[model samples]
Target: MLALRDSTQYAHMTPAHPCDSDDPERRFRPLSPVETCVDTCGLARDSAPYFSQHNKRYGVLTMANGKQATARRLKMADRAQQLQDLHFPGMPEILLWHRNRHDGFITIPRTLPIVMQAVDAQSKGQPAGHTLFCLWARSPDHPVLSIENPSTFAAEAGFIGERAVDTWRRRMKKLRELHCIETKPGASGEFHYVLLHNPNAVMEWMHSVGLVRAELYSRFIERLADVGAFGEIEAVRQLWAQQQAAEAASAAAQTAATVPAAEADATAQANAAPEASAKVQIALPELGANL
Candidate 1:
């Protein structure tokens, strides 16, 4: 019963449910009852009287035909629900839960539409799941309707639904923690746009989290040099060098401080040996005089 109800929540009914249906006139109508019965009954002399039975149940039927109809409706609803959950779960409620007046069907939520050209440029052998999330995170303005060829992406980075969701969640969390990205509430007050307009913001955040490798950093500097951002790159490089030199100098000073005081101990031993030698000579003279 719960399954049926859940399935019907998103299902498209000819006469939609009271909650979803917009027509105030039909909203008060009572739900129609469903019935079931056996068709054939046979009687023989050996067998007692055969009787046909009718199921007088009032709610929706649960027989084969009814189940099929329910299943079909549920499948469509489930797909729509999945897409909704991925793109626009609860935000910008105005656009997400809108009903089409023409066909009385609910349309899919409008995500930050990614264009095909951008997808073609970025979609290179990455998993569909990763590609989708990456597009959402990196290129929200350019939404990819469909992949031209999904095979390479599926083969290389086959991130499925759960893994993809987790990965994107972690990325967003990191971005927020570093203050590289900010979420602005949509007009509807339910949806948000993840903004990444500042390139340096992300790079700095990545550096803080140790996400940028040395080689990659060097490459980034080179690219900056190609343009006119060399001054900024050089400043960063100088800071790194200063830090490294300071650490090295501190380590050298610590090493010198740890050396043992061997020279002072050796000098003390030499002075004590001379005094002992004199004492031995004096004792020898005293013994000769007594004899």
Candidate 2:
């Protein structure tokens, strides 16, 4: 029954674009759901990707099984192996540094132990569940679910010119295609949804499951539960639910312009997926203190 310092206020404290929490030039994309997509926007992954030996950009290691892969790709894989192995490092500094700055929650990335405990005590067989709404969906494991506005969701987490509604349903559609963080229903449809699958469903059919970060996220939450932090997790959930209820119409569109982090504070409240399948998983690390 450990309490989480009444973290209900954490939501209101974050800046509009937490991505800008650190580097102004580089907007840290909300955590990758499972693994970083090899091909997409941002730093275009060449069709013939060049694995760097000392890729200082992300500090990616280039040697795995004598082959080369991006550090971004390996981070996800490392997380998966760490979970099954149960080595509690006690803070996600790597994640925060990669994203650019302090998360406002902790000076250091909290080791997955406490987080894992909190998640388990709450979710009832549902993946991530209410707790999902509590933690930052922009973490390394969860990543940004969808920045796209409602219009994007309707188009199957895509753009019409771009949009969606029936938010949860759209989320499900997005989930089935890629492996990413569990997203909320509020995306206004004009933003970029950090999804694992191609935002374009038809494209997903031709492509492959995007990011499976959700699966890992679910597992991670459960781990957090094992260590007795459920109460804190619940407090976060209650606060978030209240915020969502108050802004039902506009909640999905909490983008930079619409929800400016400053005014957003006055209004209060806020906000992955990773990379691959077999080899690695991405986004925020999953919870499972007792696994």
Candidate 3:
């Protein structure tokens, strides 16, 4: 597994958010379940390669026909528009969208690969399993998944179910409704979408949605430090402070430069007035005596 290094603290880390505990109904709602075998378990042959190809090529999978593709795309768009109306009407707009023709799925902007795994529990003569789809963007600095075999996928399933699956579903749905997922055609008649947000974008979007205070963005960065994502939160803090100071200095310089030249001319005239008067008196005395 590729770990994220905290740039500030030099510690291994992961991104985390506050877990919602208040609404049990909302929280436990049947999340988009990962199909063990699409349409039927055990009866359906493992189409892992098909899904893999879809994921690698288009980032999302969808039905092969153009009409169904168009309908799914429209449905996704409608959902996104609704989300935008509900939250994030502005800022960090969706960037790209793509889907695989072989499967009926779409990847939202900024989503990562959905890691599918066999669950420890078996389902009806078939291996019970689920997919761990990443709803949020990982820090680009972190390592992407390194699953080489099905066992690794199984291990990851545990990791994700415990840490990410629920959160992923919630956030993914929210993002989808917000139109944050961009849509486009893929090589094999599939579609692909890239999330528009990076780390900064996530911070901004969080603030936009009232999930966290603007001031908390810094603290969240610090927490990332605590989790070993960066070397130290203090270092990130210092960097941010330094950048602010530099910006302030630049703004001050620009303001100084923008001061009107006429103001400088006025000051110079005021300072020279007494000398000019004295010179005028001497010249006048000389002129009077001559006249």
Clashes of 2: 79
Highest lDDT among the candidates is held by which one? Answer: 1
Clashes of each: 11, 79, 40
lDDT tens digits by residue: candidate 1, 181-246: 455555422114555423433343354466555444434433332333334433554676799999
- Sort every candidate by TM-score, greatest first: 1, 3, 2
For candidate 2, give the lDDT: 0.34
Candidate 2 structure quality by residue, lDDT tens digits, 62-143: 2132122235346766786688458655665564344335443422222243333333333334333222232233334433
Give TM-scores for every candidate, taking all chains together and pairing residue i with residue i: 0.24, 0.17, 0.24
Q: Which candidate leads in TM-score?
A: 1
Question: Which lDDT value does model 1 have at 221?
Answer: 32
Report per-prediction Cα RMSD to one decimal.
Answer: 27.8, 31.2, 24.9
Model 2 segments beyond 4 Å from truth? 1-212, 248-291
TM for candidate 3 is 0.24
What TM-score quantifies how close candidate 2 is to the native fold?
Answer: 0.17
- Count clashing residue pairs in model 1: 11
